[model samples]
Every structure is written in C-alpha cells, then in structure tokens.
Target chain A: MLDVIKSVLAAFFGVQSEANRQRDFQAASPWMFIVVGIALAAVFVLIVAGVAWLAAQ
Target chain B: MKRFALTGICFLLLAALMAGSTYAASINTSTGWNMPPGVTDVSREVYSLHMTIFWICVAISVVVFGAMFWSLFAYRKSKGAKSAHFHENTTVEVIWTAIPLVILIVMAVPATATLKKMYDTSNAEIDILVTGYQWRWRYEYLGEDVSFFSNMSTPRDQIQGLEEKGDNYLVEVDEPMVVPLGKKVRILLTANDVIHAWWVPDLAVKKDAIPGFINESWFLVNEPGIYRGQCAELCGRDHGFMPIEVKAVPQEEYDAWLASRRDAAVAEAAGADREWTMDELMERGAGVYNTYCAACHQPEGQGLPPVFPALAGVGMSVDPEQRAEHIAMVAYGKTGTAMPAFGDTLSPAEVASVITYERNAWGNDTGDMVQPSEIRDLLGK
Candidate 1:
C-alpha cells in the first residue's frame, strides 16, 4: 500500500521532472504546486468578492 | 521561458480582439461621451472616478506588460539557459501577495469613497421621473409643468442606409430631454414594461430601469450641449433604434422653451373645440403619426408581426368606440402590452393628429378628427 502511494506521487511529479531533465533543468518542486494553488485561489476569491460588491451597488 | 512566451502571445491576441471591437466613432472622440445637462455633483464625481480608474488600468498594463516582455526576451530558452533550482522562498511568496494586497487596498479606498457619495441623492433641486418603455423614454418634471417623450430622431431610411446620413445621424432625436444648466437634477428611473438601462457614459452613470421599481440617479452639467446615448440594455428587436439625446440649454433658454411648450399645449387644447377640416387634419396627422407612431405601428399602419398588432385593418381603427380605446391605449399605454401611453410623450395636438390619422388610414375612414380637447379631457379623467 505504501509503495503504491509512493508510485502515484512519483508518477504525478516525475512526468514534469522528466520534461525538466530533457531540457537540462532542475525538476519543479512539489511545493510549487501548493504555492501556485494558494495564489490562484486567493485571486479567484478576490475577483468574486469584487464582482459581488459591484453587483450590489 | 516557454510559459512566458505563451502568456505574451495570449496577451497580444486578447489586446487585438478588444481593439477590433471598439466603435469607429468613439475613436478620437474629443468630448466625453455626451453628458446630459443638469448633471449632479455625484455624476461628475463618478465621471472623474472612471477616468482615474481608466488611467490606472493603462498604467498597470504598461508596467506589467513591459516587465513581462522584458523578462521573456532577457531570459529566453533560446539563450541556452539553465533554470534556477532555488524554489520555495517564503519571503518571495509573501512579498508578491503583500504587494498585490497593497495595490488592491489603494484602489479600493477611493472607489469606496466615490461609491458612498454616489448613493446620496437627498436635497435634489429638480426631480424628474423618467419612465423607460419598450424603445423610448418618457420624462415628467415634477412641479415644473414639463413632461414629454423622447424618441430617436434618426430616420428609418438613414438607419437602414436607404438615405444619406445626417450630421448627428443616430445620435439625433425628435424630442430631447431638456434641462436647465447648473442645476442639480435628480432623475427617478422606472420602466413601463421590460428592463431598460439609462446610461450616459459622459455622466458615468448607468442604472437599470426595472418595471414596478424606481432607481435614482442625478447629474448637473457645467456646459450646455447636446448629449446622446442609446438604450444600454437589449429590450427587443428595436433596441438599437432607441436613442437618448439631452439638450442642455442655458437657464433662460430652458425657461423660454418651457413657457412656449406650455402655451402651445394650451392652444392645442383650445383648438379642439373648433371644427377642423379633414384635409388639414389628415395632412397634419400624417406627419404626427410618422413621428410618434411609425416606429412600432409602422408608416403604413401595418405593425410588425408576432408583436405589434396591425393598426390598418384592426377593429380599433374601424369602430368609433374602439377608436377611443385605441387613443387611450396610445395615450396611456395598455398594461402587459408593447403599446405605451403617448399621454406623456405626445402633446394634445400630436396625439389627436396621430389618432385621427390611424382612424382614416388604410381604407378605415371613421370620418372623425380626434381633437386635442378630447384627449386632454380623457387624460384628466
């Protein structure tokens, strides 16, 4: 079970890692996904709030 | 590097799309979108706020796009560059988030202040009730004895490109909303039937006139000029044809115009008692019908199918009693129908003339001339 989880994680991250290898660059870290997701979610929330406020006006 | 290039391409494509869609006449437009006369302080503030935001957007776009393009070219993959391995810098993420938050805060403060000012409509100098119909605007100046309907003056021939376009072209109107300059004019907007938006970009105000609901806006123009706008909302097929033109004249001129209109209305009322010759009425009535009724009922009294019922062979035109009802419907539009009451839009003479024309046109001669006095009586009742 542990091995399967590791493989799944590797598959998700390793595809982009392989692409990076072909380009002779460092693989994108998993933390980048978390950071980007947080940023995008923040932007989406702000946009929705702004739109709602304007509609109320 | 590839991602940056893709973003750059996407931005360029979006810019081209936006540039392609803007109206040709709006380009090199010197005067701000026509501002109606008698704009209030709030409207002027809103206009200034809009310009401020627009300039801010332009500045942001220039900075952001400039940096993006510079970065793309400076650190492109074509230069055989190796990607930086350093990632997950907590400080950098915090900085980016903090900067954007600060920028939003800066933008929100003034916008909120302007918005708060816009909502206050108390102590208005002049109160005008504006009612939006299917494709026209009606105005009633409370306590001013000034009420009228404003319709698009652009000829169908010009609109259909059947004739040469005039100077104002689509922006002209048969009757414009006239207001005194340098006075705070308050407008209470409502709709007779469907939803229509009263928007004048120069005043930087657009509010939906919803049926059974009143929305308020105010404006005061510093200069006197003819300001034009269109029905911003899509109401129906003739939506594009409904235009709004406001003639803001000096206070003295406005007063004189108002007096003349009142006198003409009184004279028309008195003329109803006198017997009018059919030849005179028909000639006068034709012009009246063409201006007020032709937009929907049509020039030939053949209305548009599936919506506007035909007035030519209709029972309302043939029978005398039904003719009165037709006049009533035209004077005070029937509820739940496209027929708007012309009571507010047309003068007594104009209404009488149009009704007389409708009764006589298309082989349906009722041999009756609807006098302005009758309409005035009907309106009073």
Candidate 2:
C-alpha cells in the first residue's frame, strides 16, 4: 500500500522512473493506484482552493 | 578544455544578447508592450499578476533554454563527446516536474486572489445596467432612472476618407457612461440581440453580454479620466464601429451630470407630445438615421441587400399607402430578421423623424411627415 502511494505520488508529479513504472505494471491489479490517484487529485484541488481562499482574505 | 572554453564564450555572448534585449524591453515596458497598470485597485493587482507571470516565464525560458544550448554546444559530436545512454532519469525528471509545479502554484495564488477581488461586486455605490445592442451600448443607471445610448461619434465622412480623421477617430463616442471616481461601480451586462463583450482595458473589466443572461463586472476608478475601449466581441456588421467611452468624474460632478440627464430625458419625453414641422423632422431624422440606421440601411438608403434590404425606392418608404406598415416595421422589427425593434431603444420623436427622413431623402420622396404624437399613440405609450 505504501509503495502504491509512492508510485501514485510520482505519477501525480509526472516524473515516475522506468523501474517504478515497471514495478507498478507488474502488480496483479491497478485498483490501488486508481483509488490513490483519485484521492490525491481531490486533495490537490482542496489544497489549491484553500490557498486561494486564504490569499483572497 | 579548448572546446569547453569556446562553448563558455558562446554562452557568455548569448547571455549578453539576452541582457541587451531585456534592457530594451524594460525601457519599453508600459509604452505599448506591457499591460497598463490601470486606474483601479483590482486592475493594478491584475497588472502586477500579469507582470509576475511574465517574469516567471522569462526566468523559466532562460534556465531551460540556457541548459539546452549549453549541452548542445559543449557536448557536440565533433568534439569527440559520446552520447550517454539514459532512459527515464529519475532525479532530473523529478527536479524538473517539482520546480514547475511550485511555479504554477505560486502563479495560481495571486491569480486566484485577483479573480476573487474582481468577482466581489458586493457593496457597490452605483449599479449600472450595461446592455449591448447590435453595434452600440446602452447604459442604464439602476434605481436612478437615467439611461442613454452611447454611439460612436466619429463621422462617416472620416470613415469614407472624405474628411481628415480626428485623433480619437473610431474610439470616440457620442455619450460616455459617467461614474464617480473612488466609488465602487458594478455593471450588470446583457445583450439585446447576439453576444457582445464589454471590455475596457484600463479598468481591467471584460465581461460578456449574452442575450437573455446577465454578466457582471465592476470597477472603482482612483482618478478622474476618460477611458476608451471597443466591443471585444464581434456582434454584427458594424462591430468595428461600436466603441465604449467611460468618464470618471468627481462625486459632485457625477451627481450633477445624472440630474441633467434626468432633466433631458424628461424634456425628450415631453417633446413627443407636441407638433413638429417637416423640416424639423427631416433634420432630426437625418441625424438619427446616420447614427442608428446608416450602418445597415446605409447613409443614402442603399442597403447591402440579401441581408439588409435597401430602403431607397419602390419599397415601404416610397409607397404612401405602406406608411403605417413602415412605421410598424421600425417600431417593432420584422421577426427572424436583423432588424431590431426600436420601440424600446428609440424615442417616439426619433422614430418619427427617422421614418420621415427615409421617405424624403435618397429620391424615395413620398412627401410625408410622420408626427411623434402619432407614433406615441401607435406604441400605446
């Protein structure tokens, strides 16, 4: 699960290594990465919005 | 080492060239190149945000392109430099991606802040309803009962190259929307027909005026000045002809201006009840036609047909029997056509004069003088 989170973060940054990508694809299922990616995207939006809100004040 | 020294010299030369251009750009910054640090707080903030992003882009370009060129020259194949076999270099990719993400986030914070400030139309001292027509703008001071159409004042003679163009030219307008300096003025924008965008660069306010929908924008001028802009959206044939002029005055002057406009509107309303002469109607109608009808129907009633039909001869204006129909057509425009209903836009006097002018001018002489009272009654006003 931790390795899945790490790979998802790397993907989010758009800088995943070839080795890590191979490792990710070697997994039996992509369900973990998919779930983590979605959650991270939502969190990113929340963070940006929070920054905007704070700056606006 | 010799090749490396040559590459270093090339890099230094490139840097000097960049520095020279940067110096030139800095000197020419606000003349015409950069966005105007405008008259309002929000506009200034927007300007600063623009400049910040611009500099950031410049920095990124310098770094990225500098490294790229340096690599190309310093490791040329002719210099016996062999290519390093690499795929998906982790640290470099991560560094590049992380740096850009940080920069984007930095850009977003200030941009979002400015946007929020622009959208905050609350507690505005004045509310003006700005409605975009085919090629003109109508400004209605909400709750103040003052309204007027602002038409491009540049003469057709200048446009046709018959006369020398004035300095203001196409940017000039007959009436400018007046607002008080240091007062928050919110504008609710809408269009009568197609879409139009109200854009005044100095105020940094550009909002679309969509038919059947209202878009809002606001500005608070810190100084008294006249700002000019054009309809940013292409609405129709006379899109280039339309212009926006905004005059920001002191509070007392604005109040006085508003009062005078109210008095003029009242006088105009009263003018519709009285009898008018053929000469008076013709003269007034000529002005009205030139301002309103000339763009589509043309100055001499020779309209660009297939879309805008000519009103010169053998049509509604020439036929004495079709006088009422002509009046009706002008009052309530023909449906599914480009003709906009002038019942709401034009005064009864204006409608009467324009109709009379159509009959008299351009050899479409029907010897008719339509009265404003007659039009007032026809409109059930």
TM-score top scorer: 2
**Tens-place lDDT digits, model 2, residues B120-141:** 9999989999999989999999
TM-score of chain B of each: 0.78, 0.95
Against the true structure, candidate 2 has what lDDT? 0.89
CAPRI grade of model 2: medium
**Predicted chain A of model 2: TM-score relative to the true chain A?**
0.90
lDDT of 1 by residue, A1-57 (tens): 343333344333333233333433343554554555566567768988997698557
User: Residue B158 lDDT in model 1?
Assistant: 91
| Best lDDT among the predictions, by candidate number | 2
Clashes of each: 9, 0
User: Which tens-of-lDDT digit does each residue in B256-298 have in candidate 1?
Assistant: 9889878865676676666667777788889878766777778
